[model samples]
Target: MPLLKVLRPTLPILVGASIMLTLGMGLRQSLGIFLQPLTRDIGISVSDFTLAVAVQNLAWGFLQPMAGALTVRYGFRPVMMIGSVFNVIGLALMAMAHGLTSIIIGGGILIGIALACTASAIAMSVSARAVPATVRSTVLGMVSAAGSLGSLLAAPIGQVLSEDYGWRAGLAGFVVLSILMIPAAWYAGRVDRVPLPKTSGDEIGNTSAGVAVKAAFSNASFLVMTCAYMVCGMQLVFLTTHLPSYLAICGMDPMLSAQTLGVIGGFNVLGSLFFGWAGGRWNKLMLLGMIYVSRSLILAWYFMLPPTPASTLLFGALMGFLWLGVGPLVAGAVAEMFGLRWQAMIQGLAFMSHQLGSFLGAYGGGLIYDALGSYTMAWRIGVALGLAFGIIQIAFALIRPLSPPPVLKAA
Candidate 1:
């Protein structure tokens, strides 16, 4: 008897998608470690660093919808290749940066654009298409968790690289990694962008890119998700960018700060997996609301409690639980309402809102600290935003879906 071959179509897509997430998220998150060294060399205040990061985030936000459009006109492989190119250029420029302005151009603008083009939303959209509809949330969660693995390890690895070599060498190291992505992206080209069966529905939508944008803008649900994501961006970027510095300010050792960040990253993987499980078993909207509420409550409690190593670690753990886990839920929501065919474009547009919030969170926290002589005001503001997110998501959940708008058959 001849050996039988078993078909396993989803496996390649999963592997390709996961690799993209790990590299994209891991490298972007590690940029935070360069903040101090870059500032000292440039002779700029921390605020300058903050502003540059903020602008970088803003660039990511502004470019997202456009990239999504490109993904529509082009295909996943092409867009991802463009992203990899930008990543290499941005990191090289940043590594060789001299002045404050140059760093902004390198670290803020280029890197931000690169991340928007190739990161979580783009990769997970592809992963979403590769799986069964019922497994959508789980697949998205796995993707987020994969990225978190990068986030989890980035701090320690970045620290070690910076120590063994130097900050410049560390930056150079990632630039090399970005080069590797070029090949990975090219290989990803082998996977079909447009689904097989070449049936009418395989295409993402018949609605033109402009029409889809207009429809998404018109949808109240989309608006609510966008607004809620702003808070998500703010909270996430602020914590990730400044948490190490903040720990230092609190009189903790740098090693301890690195450890805290690592733990936060580790916890995020668990958080994403657990929430994804809940997303499949429960009402996704409600789960989203609860995540926000939990964040708000945790921030409030952290503020009320005295600062201690034990307290900080506990807070970091809780924050980790709510971290990128939101990615899968939010991305899943986009796929749920819209179609996965245009998943990258739609999610990119949504993420633009997120990066805008990130701009605010990252730079705003620095401004708050510099102005107030402490981070008190910033922490308080985070609590307020958390509450706001909860409210927005809850209100969105109450609104009825618009009769599942005509599923424009993709040709």
Candidate 2:
């Protein structure tokens, strides 16, 4: 009752955004489950398949700013509706594909574009506009947690479908689920009707989107945060894309890999919530620094320990707790610094940098494994990058409060 009472004002936006994230991110997270099966069926190397998936990440990042601009101008519903169509079509194409070309076109290009529209950037942007500033971080966290729930549920479900019927059927089933996002998109579009408060003279409200972009690009803190997000993207995609394969390579049961992903998803739910609450109450940049530092330490411990079911589960649980927790904090920081007038566009650019990292992590893991016959090099690189980024984040914490940019008048 207390929770409901607190959320009642923004419940629709929260529910709609959560559902959209659930289907959008859930399906994306489940792609790892398809790695072995799809490759086996198509007779392609893991590197090839990974390259396609990497393309998907790149495309997602490439299109993010466009999607944000569209959402800002036309509202979220139409963008979501079109995105749902792209997802359904893309999944169907992936199901029918017999070669890497088709897979890249379907899974990489179309689905990548679809995710740009349906993913957290749009969800957070709309939710930020709909909710009061006081509770924005919490709502963003709730939405992210919902997406994690999708990640949790999708792995096992995809495994079951792939194991029972076939991987193709599994993709088809996801197509059905993706269609559900259309309605959710419609519901989330209602945020456009909820008027946002006008910004004070000091805010960037009077400036053009071009000016806001220039200001964010010029801000040292924003630049640092964007760079830090690159590490987040790389680490996240590497784990999501390769964890199952890594477990299989270690001679663990395939099912355990799926379960590990599910575990991560489960823990991510709590992690996102906790980080969300903490972001509101404490220094968010410091929280990010700690998260990266913890990730480096966790990976070290995981490598040191023997690969077993218990170790794998523990790793997943710990990693899951850190998963996606940065999202709300990053979005909240952007809102705090820049205001919401161009929040979507600015955040979209930051996320684009994240996707660049995703591109490297996802594709590079496969390339390394193919070349070296193990993921050792890739994991080691992640550890080093995590530590370096962690320190960089802490340094950012020392920066003074950002001064708002000059407001350029619109023609």
Q: Which number leads on lDDT?
A: 2
RMSD of each: 3.6, 2.1
Report the C-alpha displacement of residue 410, candidate 1, in angstroms. Answer: 16
- Deviation (Å) of 73 in candidate 1: 1.5
Candidate 1, residues 1-411, lDDT tens digits: the string is 111111155656666667666777777876777776667766887778888889888988888777767766777788888888888898899888777777788788888888777787777777676666666677678767877777566677777777788778878878877777677666555555547222222344766777676656766676777788888888878877787777767777666655667777788889888877777676667678788888889878876766678888888799888887888887777777677656677777888888888988899999997887777888789889889788778767867442233434322
Which stretches in model 2 have alpha-carbon errors above 4 Å? 1-3, 198-202, 401-411
lDDT of 2 by residue, 1-411 (tens): 765677787778778988898888888887888999899999998988889889999999988988888876788789988987898889889989899988899989999999999898888888778877677788788778887888677788888889999999888888888888888888888888887655322267656778778878877778887898888888889988998888878889988978998998899889989898898888788788889989988987897666999999999999999988988888888787778877877889999999999988899999999999998999889889988998899877867444344432221
Best by TM-score: 2
lDDT of 2 at 39: 96
Q: Give the clash count for model 1.
A: 0
Tell me the lDDT of model 2 at 282: 82
Which ten residues in a row are the worst by lDDT in model 2?
402-411
